[model samples]
Target: MTQRIIKLGEGYGDVFELFTLMEAMPDRVDRLLALHTIKNDEERTSLACIFKPTNQGNFHPIYICLEGIPKPNDQRNKRYEMFKALSEQFDKPIVEFTVPPSETYHEEEQYFQQIIAVLRLNHLLPPI
Candidate 1:
């Protein structure tokens, strides 16, 4: 199986679109993830929607709104609230954890690889 991170943007206006797609295709939705991290001394989160492998191809796509939302425990946010509600509606608990700051990586691809590995180890993503 092949897995890839399809970044939408940092959690901003793009998160609403992620919610819409999740509502539209519940069947394709595999998991909801919240990656918590401390960047510049502020707690932040990255929300992601993992889709099941494609029917014809072994392509597992993980749609993400990269680190932008504030962690509820740190600071409540409307965007994060919506995601929490959406997860409840889908009956899937959000899988969350801390990861290295994105700035630690020299390239976006490197950052994605780190996230992908974390997902795979947690059994959230298929192995390569």
Candidate 2:
């Protein structure tokens, strides 16, 4: 199985798109993630949703709104609140982790690979 991160924009509109994707395929939803990080001295969160691999294509796509929302612990935001509501609707707790910010990586793909490795290590995702 191949897993890839598909980044949505980093803004409110992008978050809406993420929610739309979830609503469209609720059955395929595997995990809801809140990746917390400190960037430029400010705490931010990346909201992501992992879907089960497609039956025919075996492609696992992780949809993400990267570093867009304020960390819930620091300040509550409407977008994060919407995510929380989705978590409730889906009956999945949002899994959270503190991770290196995207700036730590030379390329965005490297950053996503690191996150995939972490998920696999924790048994949240299947191992390669």
lDDT of 2 by residue, 34-84 (tens): 999999999989999999999997998999999988888746688999999
Q: Candidate 1, which ten residues in sequence have the lowest lDDT sum?
A: 67-76
Kindly list the per-residue Cα lDDT of model 1 for residues 69-107, writing each as its tens digit: 777784568998899898998888999888888888999
Candidate 1 regions with alpha-carbon error over 4 angstroms: none
lDDT of each: 0.86, 0.93
Off by over 4 Å in 2: none
Clashing pairs in 2: none
Residue 5 miss distance in model 2 (angstroms)? 0.9
